[model samples]
Target: MAAKVLVAYGSTNGSTARIARTVAETLRRDGIEAEALPAPSVAAVTPFDAVVVGGGLYAGRWHKDARRFVRRHRRSLAGRPLWFFSSGPLDGSASERDIPPVAAVRRMMTRLDVTGHATFGGRLEEGAKGRVARMIVHSGKGGDFRDFPAIEAWADRIAKELDNRSGGGSR
Candidate 1:
């Protein structure tokens, strides 16, 4: 049987959700069973063989529900395959440092011992907020920095990794 993977996300304006859905679709296309759902909507991971959790980053913090979900399920997830991702750098060439997070969250990621952690570019709509945001957009930090090809490649890699690990003869 194919492995079932859960792609759960916490998105404020829906970018992360869209990303999760794309990932799930990619996994399915690669012959892995996958489901994309909001982080808070996932009742349990008992039915999933692997988990991918992600969230939208705002003001250097991941969405609260995403953090809560991780904390709550860390135990059950201990021996399972897990990965994490965050999206919120409005600039395409920005580094990970450009999108910082609350210190405690960093510690949480370490504790989780995720198999992979990725940071993707984000998008800021018009009239969003703060002077800094507006200034950045004006200064050329606006537009969708999401790398769809990169996301698809990452999903494909995950599918391959899971297939190899499953040893069910899919390559």
Candidate 2:
């Protein structure tokens, strides 16, 4: 049977959600069974063979929902193959080089023994929820900075790793 993977995300302005979806899609294309869902919507992680958790970065922290999800599922997560990602740099720095996870995410990763992590660019456009988001948009600082190719490449790496671990068959 194919290994089932879950890509769970916490997105505030929807960009991280999109990234999560991209990860899931890429994994599927690589022959793994994968799905993406919002963090809060997942009742349990027990069904998945592996998990990828992602969140939007805000004020040097991960989205609250992502943090809570990790806390809630720590035990299940620790026993499985796990990875993490963060999407929240309004500039090109993420694409140019590696950006480490925030402090809290780092702690969670250490606790969970996450297999890997990536930092991707973020998107903040018009119609975003918060006052600060609106102000940033109005100030012309809000725009899509996500690098789809890079996101896909990261997913591909994850798929390859999973495939190797699964004997290169249906993972």
Candidate 3:
């Protein structure tokens, strides 16, 4: 049977959710069975052979439910094929090195021995964010800065990995 992969995400204004859907679609296109689900909607991790957890970053932190879901399932996930992604750095100038710090989530991920982690750019609206979030958005630092090519490339890599593990040749 094909290895099942689940892509779960948390989004504030929907950009992250869209990215998760793209990743899931990419996996499916590679002939991998994948499902994209909202974080709160995932009742169990037992069904999937691999997991991809995605979340939006806000004020330098990943969404609360995303963190909680990982923490709750960390044990079941430890031996599984696992990947993580966060979207929030909205500026073209932002890099993994230059993006805002997310110390707490980083520590949690390190503890979980996360297999892979990706950071994607996010979108921001003028009035939706709170004062501080709005300031960050308007600080010449926010836009629809997501890189779709990079996202697809990463998803391809994950599909390859799952294919190898499932004794399937690369497409």
Candidate 4:
């Protein structure tokens, strides 16, 4: 059987959603059947052979919904192959200085037994959020620094791992 992959993401302003969709699309191109859905939309985990959980970072934290989703499915997640990613650190300072979100993701991955975790640069738009969110966006450097090539490469790695787990490529 072909491997089933779930690309679950949480986004407050939609950037992370785009990243998740791109990953699912890349996986599909690699011959895996993948589904990209918001974390809240994921009602069941039994159908997927592998899971990729992603979220956006805000104020040095991930979307609460995404964290809850993983925590809720902790046991199932521990048994199945899993990957975690967060889209943030567009300014590079966070990545350079070791931000809290990165640390939090590492802790969560260790606790959940995820196979891997990655951080990707995220975008910031002017006038696209509320006062606080806008302030957070503004206080940090603004830019669309996401690296599509890196994203695709990461997705390819996930596809390969799933292929190996499923006894080489297609089922």
Candidate 5:
């Protein structure tokens, strides 16, 4: 049977959610069974063979829902193959080079023994929720900076790793 993967995310402005969907779609295209869902919506992580958790960064911290999810599922997560991702940089720096996870995320990763992590560009467009978001958008600093190709490549790598672990040949 194909390995099942879950890509769960906590997105404030919906950008990270879209990125999580892209990752899930890429994994599906690579022959893995994958789905993306909001972090708070997931009741358990036990059903997935592997899990990728992502969140939008705000004020140098991960989205609250993501943090809570990891805390809530730490035991189950520690026993499974796990990865993490953050989407929050509003500039091209993420695409240009590696950006480490925030301090809290790093601590969780250590506790969970996560397999990998990535930082992708973020987006803050009009109609975003918070006052700060609206200010940024009005100031013309809000725009989509996500690199879809890079996101797909990262997801593809995860699929390959899962395939190897499942003893399935590369797709």
Candidate 6:
């Protein structure tokens, strides 16, 4: 059977959503059925064979909606391959500093029995909405730090993994 993948994200300034769409597109290009949807739209997850959940980091925490989505559907998620990612790094510095995964996410990842998790740099604009965002932007650590090549590479890995999992490719 062709593997169907769902790429869902919680985004504040649209960066994570764009990343999710790109990942979905990459999977589709590789002949997989994939869709990118906001976390809120995914009322259920059983339709997809695999899932990639991501969200923007805010004040050192993931968007509440993303966490809640996982919490709401963790039972179903456990029966499938699942991956998590966090996007929030200002201008490469956060990545360069070797920032660790969010504390809550680390615990959740263990409990969810997810396949894997990754972290990526994020984009920031000067006038980004929200008080915390504004303060961070005004602090002079703002720019498009996202690395497309890395994101694409990650997607490729995911596609290959899904292919292997679906019994469609030789490992």
Top-TM-score candidate index: 5
lDDT of 3 by residue, 72-103 (tens): 88888888988888898777643444453378
Error at 98, model 5, angstroms: 0.4
Give all candidates' CA lDDT scores.
Answer: 0.81, 0.94, 0.83, 0.83, 0.94, 0.85
Identify the superior model by TM-score, candidate 1 or candidate 4: 4
TM-score of 6: 0.92
Clashes per candidate, residues 3 or more apart or on different chains: 0, 0, 0, 0, 0, 0
Better of 3 and 5 by TM-score: 5
Taking the tens digit of each residue's C-alpha lDDT, what string does model 5 give over 59-169?
A: 899999899999998988987999999999999999999999999999999989999999999999999999988999999998999999999999999998998888887
Candidate 6 local lDDT, 1-171, one digit each (tens): 888999989998888888898889988988889999999989899999999999899888998878988999889988788888889887675445555569988888889887877788898887688887888789887778887777777788999998888788953
TM-score, ranked from best to worst: 5, 2, 6, 4, 3, 1
| Model 4 agreement with the true structure over 1-171: per-residue lDDT tens digits | 678999999987787998999999999999999999999989888889889999898777888878988888887787889998888776765345433346777788888778987788887777656576687668866677677787898899999898888788553
Q: What local lDDT score does residue 16 receive in model 6, on the 0 to 100 scale?
A: 89
- Model 2 clash pairs are none
TM-score of each: 0.85, 0.97, 0.87, 0.88, 0.98, 0.92
In candidate 4, list every pair of residues with a backbone clash. none
Off by over 4 Å in 3: 94-101, 126-129, 137-140
Candidate 1 lDDT, tens digit per residue, 1-171?
688999999887677888899899999999999999998988898899999988888788887778888987888778888888788887765342434444656777678777777777877767656676677668866778788887888899899889888886566
Indicate the worst ten consecutive residues by lDDT in candidate 3.
Answer: 92-101
lDDT of 6 at 113: 80
